[model samples]
Target: MIVKFFKNSGGGSANATMNYLLGKENDREGARLLSGDPELTKRLSDSLNFQNRYTVGVLSFEEVNLPDDDKRAIMESFESSLLAGLDKDQYNMTWIEHTDKERLELNFVIANVELTTGKRLQPYFDRVDRPLVENWKQVTNHEYGLTDPHDPDKAQAVKTLNRQNLPKEVQQLKAQI
Candidate 1:
């Protein structure tokens, strides 16, 4: 399955960000907040007192995939997607998974923008996320076939079972059977 990502911008955003992600607040408490690092999350929030920071949001494909079940894989995939687009190296990040919502999603609180080259650190959807997601879809589809129900095309949806049942060697195998 594929994962989708997005971004947002704001200030004092950390307290609110942490609260939302970690489920400290009232309405927010119900979400899974799958990641646990309260100390690191607090540190990340503390790191962004003055400078700029962007909230990089991550959303899983409509259907959750196996990797989604692994915290390490999810974190790695999230970071990989983040780094592949931006050149920045030194930045603080904290992400929380939203499971109780309509769709499974993750909100990454990224701050402490300290890129050596001083380039922008905020993730641009088109420039960074799209290509990554598209490439993931292509590669995974190529290997797994795009028919997974979560795939954009619903490649193997039962509604199209006719295609799955088609015989590849009708003439050659009819008599042998």
Candidate 2:
């Protein structure tokens, strides 16, 4: 499981983000809203009058394909852990599930305005929040037995043929060739 944050557009609007998440801008096959109300989220952002109206990101699950129930549980866990400090009612989040790739992906758009105070809320700050997010990814991966992005062995290393180190079958086949 990997938590990847998208670079927030300076002038990003909630409606635009919602449209992208909803696959209006591009053809996203097998994409569906997992949670939250798009219209209400947009309305909340629109009411705020902030330039950067939302934070957009995706939680990518590599190699492990999960059922819808498990996916929802994972999503809830990730969201709750990632936004632990924020009260439930103070923020709004919209989750979209995408399974077009080999792994499952949950794309999210978080409205930046605090519902209670109408104040700008940046969900993630690089210097402060990155470690927390990274820790969450590591812990969640271990707990769910998902792929660990931090594992060096999990990375695809470039291969070069070592003639002497070839397997017996490969060496025999090569000799015949």
Q: Quick one: best lDDT, which candidate?
A: 2
The deviation in Å at residue 146 for candidate 2 is 0.5
Candidate 1 deviant stretches above 4 angstroms: 1-7, 25-30, 33-39, 42-51, 64-71, 84-90, 115-120, 123-125, 137-177
Clashes of each: 2, 0
Clashing pairs in model 1?
Answer: 147-155, 147-156
**lDDT per residue (tens digit) for residues 40-114 in model 1:** 646654555554445545645353433444545556565676566544245556666666655555556565455
Residue 88, candidate 1: Cα error in Å is 12
User: What does candidate 2 score on TM?
Assistant: 0.79
How high is the CA lDDT of each candidate model?
A: 0.54, 0.78
Residue 73, candidate 2: Cα error in Å is 2.4
User: Candidate 2 at 99: error in angstroms?
Assistant: 0.8
Where in model 2 is the C-alpha error above 4 Å?
A: 25-27, 156-177
